[model samples]
Target: MSRTSHITRTTGETGVDVQVGLDGSERTVEVATGVGFFDHMLHQLGKHGGFDLRINVKGDLHIDSHHTMEDTAIALGQAFAEALGDRRGVVRFADASVPLDEVLARSVVDLSGRPYMVHDEPVELAPMIGTDYPTSMTRHILESFAYHARICLHVSVLRAANPGQKPDAHHVVEAQFKSLARALKYATRIEGEDIPSTKGVL
Candidate 1:
């Protein structure tokens, strides 16, 4: 069976469309969220996770990027959950550590059918990575995604080496996204013919 899902979500704040294929190797990605940096991050997520993903969002950008970012995350999470189906024969837990220059990020994921998040950034970042991507919203995005996807996720910045200063926001955030992608990719892999849980369900 093909592990694929398409989702369209519309609210007073935004309209989002997302499509995802879990067992994909094409690394195909098309994302336009009205925020350049966010689009870049989503591309990284799909590429590194070995998933084909497409996202198109129209949001109330006249105010800020909050609605666009959060709504996109939610829709993407919904797509993932739908695609996963019964979560059978899957490696349900995984962790990854990724580094980019001076930033080292670690992410752990559990497809537990419950929403939970624990996020920590040891290094301070600039207020913004680009013209519109706020550093603060990074955690919120992860939280929103985990919540809607019903996954337990933990992400932490383990090390930031700049000899005495904070790492660049872009590098830090990129490393986190890459780590998350890798972790999720491993967790979602089809490993066996049964659900990977003691309770016989996820």
Candidate 2:
């Protein structure tokens, strides 16, 4: 089966476009969101998810990165949901745990056609990764994506820093995205011939 979707979302605050192939061999991906750190995280998602994903977004950056980040996630989430369609023959539920230096993150996902999310980040971040990407926007972005995609998602930072180690926002956040990517890859995989839920629809 072919699973792919292209979506465009234009609003007064932002304009976003996304293309996704859930089961592509090449995994060709391109993303340009004008936010450096956000772009890096999206790259991690695409690279680790083992899918073909593309995203382009333009927003009122003069105000802040909030609009751009949220809108990008919204469009990307819509693309994924569209690609999955009826959620046929997919794993539908998966989890992943990943560690990066001083940070460890775990993600669990269920594609139940319901939107719900729980995010827990115990580590204290530096507030901003750089001049553009705000660490506070991390939860907002993930929440927006899960809400739009109609998925049940739970993310937690199991580890952050030690006595001597310092909290690095990049590592902390990147670990979350990477773990989420793996979970999504597994959950979106075609593993069976029928829908995963008893309700007969997802």
The Cα RMSD in angstroms, rounded to one decimal, for candidate 1 relative to the true structure is 1.0
lDDT of each: 0.93, 0.92
Instruction: Report the poorest 10 consecutive residues by lDDT, candidate 1.
Output: 122-131
Q: Write the per-residue lDDT of candidate 2 for residues 116-150, one digit (tens) a residue.
A: 99999954689899999988899999999999899
* Pairs clashing within candidate 1: none
Error of 2 at 134 (Å): 1.0
lDDT of 1: 0.93
Ten-residue stretch with the least lDDT total in model 2? 22-31
Q: Please write out the lDDT profile of model 1 over residues 85-184, one tens digit for every residue.
A: 9899989999999999888999999999999999999536889977899999999999999999899999999886678886788888999999999999
Q: Which segments of model 1 are wrong by more than 4 Å?
A: none
Which residue pairs collide, candidate 2?
A: none
